[model samples]
Target: MHTTTSDTAPEQRTAAPRHPVARAGRISAQGAAALVLVLLLLVVVRLPWAGDLGMHAATVERLRHGLLHPGNPLIDADTPSPYYSPWTLLLGIVAKLTGLSVFVVLRLGALAGLALLVTGVHRYVRTLTAHRAAPALALLSLLFLWGPALFSWSGFLGLNSLALTVSYPSVCALGLTFHFWAWLTRAARGPIGWGAGAGLGVLWAVILLCHQFTGVVATLGGLAMVAGARPARATLLRLGTGLLPGLLVLWLWPYYDFFALFSAGGDLEAVHRSLYRDLAGRFGYVLLGVVALGFRLRRDRRDPLALFFALGVLMVAAGGLTGHYSWGRALPAALIPAQLAAALQAVSAGRWALRRGWACVLLVALVAGAWTQAGTLGYVVRRDALPGAVAAKYREPWAGYQWIVRAGVRYGDVVMARRFPARQIPAYGPYTVAPGYPDVFLPDADRREAAMKRYFEAGTGDGERRAILRAYGARWVVGGAPAPWLHKTAVGPRGQVLYRVAP
Candidate 1:
């Protein structure tokens, strides 16, 4: 059924292109300025490159290959994931268009950029609250100083945990925006719009799959929004419907996977081990949010966004105080609501300070503080944003994991490596790993292959290696040095060792 605009003359259709509100155009400049300021303040948050460590890179690479032949085992089917289809579908489209290898880093660049855009969304959402925009922007400015700055030298860069730490807030911001939008429009009697619903669904789904650790904060933020609803049943429907995409993944978590951030017998213990470490990384963020929340609640205390944001920060901070801490990674999912709430307060503070005639002094202080903290922001930006730097890093010799572009790795062979190394290869279904040759193959800790370590060091006999290569199947062994059979050696872009073991 074709629908026309009442078949009215196209010229007579004087409907101007829609803006969220008429003032959006005027405010857009301010919003963009805020975003750029946020982007620039923690300019280093962009980082040295878009973070293409091991598995993250490998997943994109495998997906790239899978696009060419879906059923073909470019990567295996039984990898680990919750089957969150939407983001994976988006990733697949990206893989088909760009291929997996190049996308290894390419995708991270895009992801980091997406993370950065949260500042803009934060600004836009702040616009709704009106009075809170300034401090909200300032708070965002300060947030750039938190994770990346603290973690840049925390010695955990290139690790999944740190990546989760940084990316969680970005995801949280998006969730908060959607939740606020949903609550703001919940009274609409006409068909409840799908725009906010679909958008929130997609973003949260991506967050769930990206790393479940973010669950700590994002979940908190989500509940805050639900609490804002007028009718309990409607709110229940909204929240439940919103989680549909994530539910899909939870159902399929046993089978489909991109990386195993969460799995039985694996690093589940690591999550416990990381408790205090996570708390320390997130201390500054929690503090700032608390202060910002205190200030924002001073005025329009009734706003649900404000209340939820305050509660979340207090809750997480209290948890930290009482040793429930984990950099809130045990709760990063709460990051969205908390930050949104903080942003609301921060913007309010900023506006008040500015309107009260302290705007110039405060803004300068904000920028100066961020600039001093450039070490943090500069890492992510310098890594990938610089021209040719990303490509150059991957071209041959590299320092950080250079955000490189490649067709993708073809992993149809056995891979032999250590605990961490074994974990990184799950995305490549085309390969298996070995230690004692022929018998013990899987290196997954959860897989209970006790002999995995010995396999990497001793599995490389000339004839046996040839036979292992032929029988078990493998194209490359990364980050490991073995005997004569592990032919064709090279260091990875990130300086991890690699061997082009023949399939």
Candidate 2:
């Protein structure tokens, strides 16, 4: 009997345990407890409430109240919001099942996503390393060194500071992106079959539904995975067939919106800011990866990690040249791939150092120090906002707006305000707000912003303000000072008045 090398490879691979139960049993009690404690600390950390989170919560509220018959609940006659999201669906389900407020649900969702992301990354690192100790060390490094800068290096995207403040959809989408990569890598390695292919498509669809850009990156990474795996024609055909669901999602609604997104140019200046200054604010793990890559350690030629790393570097370069839409929406997602490669390098280094005595200790200490520094930076970013699930406690900030709502401020009623919090009144209150545009994706946003400024600060008298407001269908004025010419229906705690404007 002739035995080929391939005949014994399967047996050897099967001999290596990959099951969660098998892996869990190998975890030290102390390590498990420490992980639990760290997770708990992350959960307990204060999550701030800001306009974006509030807007998402409000949108979820609309979804929950009319789950069976849904419309764009946030849009009114004055403000047209043609927004669609799968995050709303997830939040609606949680809210319906648990009967919790959208605020609480968002917090829970963010925490869950974060936990999954950390675990998924840890598993990914373990697969890349020669020793299990490397995974543990890498996990610790991620926790301490990972700064929450969501977009560029500046912590401006609310990372470390306002990360929890962004809509849970984006955060959950990011987490989904990570898992999507992991699952795709597995399917790519397996024998091409209906199950694997269909699963890939389904996961791709889910990731797209969760967040569009993250979905695109997932798709790109999937393609890269296919290219790296270099499967047979039959396998490639099966995989293509499996990805039908994802194609269907694009065909359904995403294609139209996606086309619209690109039709309007991105913000190149924002890209420059992120690449030159902001991209370095968080994720010290990136530096570790660069240093490790410099070591020129031999990596597997077919390693998906290499492809992902190349893709990430490509993203940074491309991200810098694209407009705002690409920069804000698609580019930041490159962090997932970059982190994956960096983490692999970091873990490999740890595994290498295990043989070199105390060098590993010194390296870990450096990472720990970097984490401490990142934490300090995070504190500076988040210090202005109150913590602990702002959605649940948002009423304090919305007190003035709530008063206006209680005063019978009708739906579609437009109010003008220039203040930051004033702009948020529409999301928190029952009425619409005019000269208060929130969308950055629209092509005419610059025009609308300029028009809004003209309506507020540029106007000299009540006649000018009234004419401008009337044109946009403005019927109220929400601000710290009342428009003396208009009738004040209510005055809020901070002396903010909701004045009734006549057509």
Which predicted model would earn the best lDDT?
A: 2
Candidate 2: C-alpha lDDT: 0.51
TM-scores of the models, in the given order? 0.60, 0.73
lDDT of each: 0.41, 0.51
What's model 1's lDDT at 418? 53
List model 1 lDDT by residue over 1-503, tens digit each. 11121212122223322335423523643574466445533433333233223333344445555543343121232333332233344555676675444334434444553444444455435324444243334334434424422343111211222333233233333334344444433422123444555555655655555445443344555555444333345434654676676566555543245344333332334444354465544434445455545555564354444556655557656746765443444343334444444433323323343423433333443444344343343334543654553333322211432211122344454555555545445444334453211111123433323434433545554565455445445566565555565554555654676666643
Off by over 4 Å in 2: 1-46, 65-83, 93-99, 126-167, 254-256, 266-285, 294-297, 321-325, 328-338, 341-413, 429-431, 434-448, 473-475, 487-503
All models, RMSD in angstroms: 9.9, 6.8
Q: Candidate 2 lDDT, tens digit per residue, 5-57?
A: 23111212223235464345235422743653353445335444444555666
**Cα miss at 17, model 2 (Å)?**
16
CA shift of 368, model 1, Å: 6.3
Enumerate clash totals for all models, in the order shown.
60, 14
